[model samples]
Structure formats: C-alpha cells, structure tokens
Target: RESNNAMQMVEGLGEDDDLLRVAQELPEPSDLLESDDDAPIIRLINAVLTSAVKENASDIHIEPYENRLVIRFRVDGVLKEVLQSRRAVAPLVVSRIKVMSKLDIAEKRLPQDGRISLRVAGRAVDVRVSTMPSGHGERVVLRLLDKHAGRLDLSHLGMDARTQATMDALIHKPHGIILVTGPTGSGKTTTLYAALERINDNTRNIMTVEDPIEYYIDGIGQSQVNTKVEMTFARGLRAILRQDPDVVMVGEIRDLETAEIAVQASLTGHLVLSTLHTNTAVGAVTRLRDMGVEPFLLSSSLIGVLAQRLVRLLDPATKEAYRASDYECSVLGVDPADPPTLYRVPDGLSAGEGYRGRTGIYELVPIDDSIRTMIHDGAGEHELERYARTLSPSIRDDGLRKVLAGDTTLEEVLRVTRGD
Candidate 1:
C-alpha cells in the first residue's frame, strides 16, 4: 500500500509540475526591490501583505540573519517559511515594515510597536506590528486582523459532547466570573468570543474591554485599551461598570487590580468573562488565589474555568503524515477498539490534504456546589484536578474518544493536550 501510494504521489507531481513552478516562482518582497530606488521595497511589502490577505494568513514573521532574510506565515497555528531573500535585501525589508507601521526606523537596539491598515482585495485589514532586537538582527512580527472572520459558534470550537454540555451549563449562569485560561495562540480569545456570542441579546448590555478589539459584534459595546493614555484594563473596567452592563468581557486579567475588578463585577449584578494564563482549568483558581484574590470571593463569584491549547492536526488525506506514537496513545488512555488518529486541522486553515487548520482541545471546570465548597475551604489546584478526574469521564479521555470517533484528529488533540 505504501509503495503504491508513493508511486501515485510521484505521478500526481509529474502532472502538476506547471502549477508547482508558478507557486514556487511567486516573487518574495526582496526580489522586487531595486538596489538604489526604495519605492520598490514599499511596493514589494504591500504586495507581500496583499498576498497574505489573499492566502488568509493570520500572522507574518520577518527574521533577519547574517546572510539571509526568512519570511514566515502562521496559518491556523502552524508557522511555515514562505520566502527567503539575499543578505543584501534584509535591511530594506525591515525598514519597509518599520516605515509602514510608523515605528522608529533608525532605532534597532530597542523594541518598538505600531499598527497600520491596508485594503486588499477591496477588504480592509488591520495589521499590528511589533519589533524586538534579536541576536542575529531585529525580529518583526505582524498580527493580521481580518474583521470579516467574526465570532464563531460555540459548537464549532471542537468541544466533545460532554465538555460542551458542561460549558453550556456554566455559561447560562446569570452572574459569576468565567475564566478561559490558556497560553498565547491557544484560541483563548476565540473561546471567550463564542461564549459572549451566546449571551448577547437585545435585553442585555454586553461590554468588552480589549487591548485592541480583534473582532467586532453588532450588539456588544467594545472598548480598546490605550495604556499610553492611561486607559488600562482596571480603569476600563471601572468605566464599563458605570454603564450598567449585564455581562462584561475583559480581554485578559493581567494584574491584581483587574482581577479584583472582575471579581467585584461578578459579585455585583454582572456576568464576567475573561482569559487567564494557565495550563489547565483547575490551575486558574490557584492562579487567582496566588494573585491575592480571597478564596471566599473566588468561591462565590467563580462560575467556571476553561483551559486550552493549540496543536497541529494530522493531514487525514496525506498518507505519509505523522501519527501519534504508541506512547501518546497510552497517555491519552486510548481504547483498543478505537485508536486516536490525526484527522482534522486547526481553525482558519486552507492547505494540505491531511491537515489545513488547527482545532482546540479544552478542559472545562464548572463550579458546582461541591466544587464551590472545596474552593471555600481553600482547596488547591491539585484538589480541583483530582475532583475533575473523579467525574464520570475525564476531559482528556472524552477528547480522545472524539478523536477516535473521527469528530476531530488525534494530532490536534495531542497538539493541544500534549497527551504524551
């Protein structure tokens, strides 16, 4: 079977050589620039960005080395190099981005940041640019924001049936704090946006405070944080509270002041949704407690916690795609009748047969009466994990079941869950 597959792939490649050549020949930004005239560099950068929008890339990375410039794009959650330029052209590319973003082009030793808006294919797109000094040279990262890719439904987030049910129950609560915890690029914003979408209605006033609002919803009031002007998360929350919102979404709880305000908002008449940096749902409680939040306040105001991660999916259509090793299967407690397989890709993807996008694997902890009592008694993160494990079936176990059932891919599960 493997030999036949390889022969077929070779034949297919032979038939598509022209298409492959065109794709390979797509010019890099540096290739379009002239040695003396700088206009080409600007045009080239715009062209690259235009291509990115056309290709639906979420982020672009420009890394400069001693002898070359490497350009990479993050689609879904995977970073893949798209172009390489000669050493002579690296400086021009970097300066082009800095100038477009309105950063200090002359300063290379320090970090700088700015944003720009460009219209590609008749659609407006926002790009957030940040540059930091690296060992080889300056590293620039551009986060692409497409307003059209609005909030998604909760059911579309790849949660298993049991986990989805638990999450739904928690979000239906009228007043409490729900924390979605995960590292960066783990779909924290997407998950919270799904929850907010569910609760938004004509009867309720929903307000959100984000550093720079990523997505806009029609009925919700969104505020952007401007730290340069002293409009921060804490201050924003205070202002949002005065507006008598029934539900609030804080982009992230980064400090004690914001955490305290979020808790207080929940204790009052509002339901608060926010994100935290933690590895698991249970860890969220411990993190809050460690951040100086009173246990009693947490026990009362906390509704639920969701911890998630992003992982690569196995391309189901790619015969030679990597599979979960036996060790990974064991860690996820895979059943013999139905083994885990890499099947589906992540969100916002379009490429490769086996995997084109990434999916989110989440563990949810809803604060039931018993769990609330545990929190009230100062039960640590371990206690919450233990209790979560004692439930009928675990999130990890159930997630593996979904992989085996072909609802999602094991590659995605392991990517986010780190099963082994």
Candidate 2:
C-alpha cells in the first residue's frame, strides 16, 4: 500500500515532460524580447504552473539575485531551489506572471498582488501572485490552491479519538463560539472550515465574512470583506448576524469590534466559528480580553478552542520503529524502553504517497463549568493552560502518538510545534 501511494505521487510526471522541458530549457524571456506576440509567454506560464502542480508544491517562487535567477518550490513547509537561469531574463518572466494575475505589467517599481486561474493536467488551479521589489530585481511568489488537495472531513483531520469526540460535541452546540488558534500557516483555517462543512446540512442558514474567501463551500453564504468600501470584519459580521444565519464563521477575530460581535452573536443562539492568532488554546482567551472583550461576555459565549499545527505524515514505506531517547520520552511522557518513536528517512520513497500530505496535531480546550469560572474570574494564560490539561491532551501528547504509530516522526512534530 505504501509503494502504491508513492507511485501515485509520481504517476503523472510523464505527461508533464513537455511542460517541464519548455520551462527548464527555454532561454531567458529577455532573449525573445524582439517579438511582441504572447504565445511563448503563455507557454512559459503554463510550464511553470504545470511543474509546480505535478510536484505537489504549495507555492512557487522566482527570485532574482545579483548574478542569476533561482526557481524554488515550497513543499511540506520547506523551500527547495529547483531551477536556475540567467538574471537578465527574470524581470520579463515576472511580467508575464503579472499579466496572468491581471496586475500592472508596466509598473515594476511597486509591489502588487493578484490572483489567476490556470488549467494544469486538465484541472483548474488557483494561483495567488505576490510580487515585491528587491535590491536586484522583482521577486515573484505564487501560492497554489488545488481544489482536490484534500477532503474536508472532521474525522479525517488527524485528531486523536478523544479530541475528535470533544470537537463533535462542541460544534453541534446551537450557540457559543468555537475558536481555532494558531500562528499564520498553522492549518487553523482548515480545521475551522472542516467544522463548518460538517455542520452544514442545509438545515441552517450559514454565512461567513472572510478577508478574501479562500474555499467555496456549497450551501453556505460566503462574503468577502473589502476594507476600502468599509466592509471590514467587524462591520461585515454585524451585517451577517442580521441575515439570520444559524451558523456564522468570521474568517478571523482581528480586532476588538469583530471579537465583540462574534461573542455577542454566540450569546444570541448563533454558532460562531472563527480563527485567532495565538500560540496556545488558552492564549486565545487572553487575546480576546486584551482586545477589551469583557470577561463575563466572553465566558458566557465560549464553547471551546482548538490549537493546531500541520505536521507532515511519514512515508510508511520507509518508517522504522526506534527506541526513544531520554529527552524524547520526557517530551512524550512515555517510557524509553518502549518503541515510542517512529523515525522515517528524510528523503521519502515518493513525493505524494510517502510524505505527500499533512494532518492536524491538536490541543483542544472544551469550556466546561470550571473553565468558564476561570474565564469569568480573569485567569492568566498559564492558569488556564494548567486547568485545561486535566481535561484534554496537549498538542505534544497527540503528536507523539502519531510518532509511536508510524504516522509521523518526532522531529516533524517538534518542528511544527515550534519545538515545544
């Protein structure tokens, strides 16, 4: 089964030979500057995107240095440089990308951001383009959004059985807030969105206010926030509440007004799902209080908080059981004589199958009576953490189990946990 999965990861590379050849072998776009036609440019764009998708890359980066141009891809949260070309041609290549994203090709001095859709391997792939001015030239980064990348199932999110059960109970509550807390790129959005998808049975009015809508879910009324026109998170959320949504997802609680509105909505029989930028589940409560949300109001409307990080799954084909070190056992709170860790080869057998995808390692805090009392009394983050630990497993504990089960490595878990 492991080998079969690895095979699927590299299965379609043969079909991308044409596109990769054009992208890798073609001379600098500057060399073809004499022609005004855009066919070659379009082909170049296709090649870059096709290679990126085939490699299961999350983002593609084109960087220009003093003497050369470097093409890199970010896979499994690490950036690896894959291609190199002449420095003179990098600017023209970036301009072609700007064209696709509908950004101003003529304005290279200023930073710009835009999005574009491309057909790769007969599928639509969304690319978010961000270009910035640099010392040598402009740098281009494209975030690839694949529609079929993963299924939005709550049970399949890689939580421990207990955490999954706790989540199932909280999300079904008719009111109160469920917040997923993590730093940027820690997979908070995926977890919250999965919860929304799970409860979205077309029996309730669902609505969301996102800065920019990332995923499209059927039967949910999604709105994008445009600050220029005064459609900010706080204002938009207030509007959403008026629309009679049974469930509401605010992309993020970015400010005081938004946090207040979401908490108030939760008190009024609306299930509010939102994300917060914090390191721990307990930290979310302090974060809200720091934004001036009253403790009583917050405690009354809070259901639970999920603190999560995305860790790469090991290639089962290459994973091997190993004795845990003293430090490892201490971190996981397990015996060293036991096979407490599953170590895998850094270079997996294949791209997609072995370490092809990621799963959530989480620490969840379900706000019970005791937790609510602590919140109302204005407890500190550490006190909340200490209290929550008795009810739910820490993120580190959940991650170590995956290590013991050959699902991931201890080092991968530590890396995503910020070395906790």
What TM-score do all the candidates reach, one by one?
0.81, 0.91
The sequence of per-residue lDDT tens digits that candidate 1 reaches over residues 290-383 is 9999999999999888877664445555434235667766766655355445444544555543454666676777778998999999987777
> Candidate 2 on 1-420: residue-level lDDT in tens?
212321232333346456546666665555578777655555665666777787788899999999998888888777877777778768778887776677898887999988775556766566778999999999999998766534778888898778898999999999999999988888787787788888889899999999677777888899998876998999899999899899999999988988988988998899999999988889899999999999999999999999988888776665666677888777777776673545775554544345756888899999999999999999988899899999887887788788878788787888877744
Q: Please count the clashing residue pairs in each candidate, in the order shown.
A: 10, 0
Compute the lDDT for candidate 2. Answer: 0.81
| Per-candidate RMSD, Å | 9.0, 5.6
- C-alpha positional error of residue 171 in candidate 1 after TM-score superposition, expressed in Å: 3.1
lDDT for 168 (candidate 1)? 83
Where model 1 places Cα greater than 4 Å from the true spot, the runs are 1-39, 135-137, 319-329, 332-353, 390-395, 407-412
The residue pairs found clashing in candidate 2 are none
Candidate 1 all-Cα RMSD: 9.0
By TM-score, how accurate is candidate 2? 0.91
